[model samples]
Target: MTDTSPASALDQDPPRRGWPKVDKVWLALLAALLALAVLDRAQLGPSLLFTAQALWDILPFLVASVLIAAWTKATGLDRHVSRVTAGNPARAIGLAALFGALSPFCSCGVVPIIAALLAAGVPLAPVMAFWLASPLMDPQMFLLMLSTFGWPLTLAKTGAAIGLGLLGGAVTQGLVRRDLLGEVLRPGVAPTCCAAKRSLKPEPVAWRFWQAPQRRATFRASGLETGHFLLKWLALAFLVESLMLAWLPAESIGAWLGADAWWAVPLAALAGIPAYLNGYAAVPTVAGLIELGMTPAAGLAFMLAGGVTSIPAAMAVFALVRRRVFALYVGLGLGGALLASLGYLLWAGGGSAG
Candidate 1:
């Protein structure tokens, strides 16, 4: 016979007692700073400044995007995702690809928005399309690329962004159709903030969420949780990015990618997996590489590859999905980048040679 009393249950499952622990992300940030101080004291100040500046620059987008996700959850706007998912699959995928390419959200900033969508039962295909493209190109990036490179390269990158989104969406759709993509979200990840407590059926929208006490509470809790989650990861990501910039010179990237051999294009894409700084920072680097004899096609490959798989972007994706889904995300990014590069090469009439 089992002892089923409350006392027995309490004894069996004791509550933990201690001060709240710091998350690994915060510890990682601290560790990076300490290592910089010990090894290269001169870079310590610069690195700190760089992380601070980058965080500051992104804070507005972070706040706005987080609030949007929270609002959607609190007011039941997520029902609209069901409507979208119910539409024609091909049309939804195409629209999502185009919209993601034009959306202002950065790679990391779009995480919370997509989390809400997925948790609310949005189909994986269109979400994957947006996930692939949102990090690659935006209006600001397009203009910046135009100024740094010529119009041809800028247009090529924009095209790559949309094309990659389409390819990723189509692949994800096939996998989902075959019932291969099981349980995309990692267990217990963003359960509260992203509204992972999903309903079995769509709920009606309550546009004025503030009118109800429960809805107001949900809004506050969701926003706070999402904000905290984003801050820690982005802080660590920016710190790592700062370290990468300080250690890896643009000239080395140029040298590795400057070769005229056919292999250099794919090599550039692979190198970009780790070597990329960010879209804004990459423009001048690629331009310098071109001046240093890197072909236009290779530069395009490097930028397209890095745009999707940068450390910050990849980190965001890893935090949201299970390992298998994350693997797919990376594979799509690398493969799509290569294909886009080849297409641009063919269309540009031998690219640099022409």
Candidate 2:
């Protein structure tokens, strides 16, 4: 017979701490905004339309993201990336740019991940590239562009993102010294597979899939980890979407960025840098601008430039890397956006006249 007293239970196992407390104030604020969104029927139609458009626009980005994520997991590319970044600065930048183009996280969502990667001894250049590219190159943003702006503009944005990433990485590799990383930089860890050199470890393929009893545990673990990582960031992104949907005026933007206005593209690129808005928020704004008379090219420039050149992003990179590296990242993004815009104008002109 077992004793059922509380003291007996306490003696059997120590109490465990609960999960971290949610920010109730933030939750309340989100709830209030959501209520307002539901109540404001006048704005509902347009908001839904914009969101639908955004959903369509982001499809390509989504497809690309799926492919990239699968590739990373299958190839053990994260481990390889960690090794390359640790060993050579140039390779680090290239890999970072490549990874950034493929990663699903937006700018704000990526902050903690970037910090973790840096802490884990990834090279500064690639880390910076990841910061720049994550917002610009994600799958949802690509789908949003495809639906709202069309393919030409989507391609241009993609090109600019890749170009800026490469240029930024190269500049960072050349300019930022490893010593500046200080305590953040550490010796690289070998791949988990490599680290476990003994035959005692299970094969990689078998380990990826588990026995029925273990499979359930593995799925639960993965779900918990992913949910913890994405939930807060997703909430923030949704809030940004709500704000943009409520405020940005379509007519004013169309009038401001009309195709005949050659200066509009560069102006848009410059204006975008300080906004700190991600592609998720900016897409609706661009759609509004399109309705306002902004050309596809000009809108694309705003989207790409806005996502990559935000003050928060710049400052983040500057804090982690050197001033020269930061400057180069900014310059490349600004320059690439401008070039893409110009090319669009020329192409559109030929198409219209032809």
Candidate that would win on lDDT: 1
Model 2 RMSD, rounded to 1 decimal: 10.1
- List of clashing residue pairs for candidate 1: none
- Name the lDDT of candidate 1: 0.77
lDDT of each: 0.77, 0.55
lDDT of 1 by residue, 37-116 (tens): 99999999988898789779888877876787678767777646666586798888898899999987766667766776
Which tens-of-lDDT digit does each residue in 91-199 have in candidate 2?
A: 6677677778777766544654654454333666777677677778767777877787677767677766776677766666655564433333212211222322321
Look at candidate 1 and tell me the lDDT of residue 184: 83
Per-prediction backbone clash count: 0, 11
How many residue pairs in model 1 have overlapping backbones?
A: 0
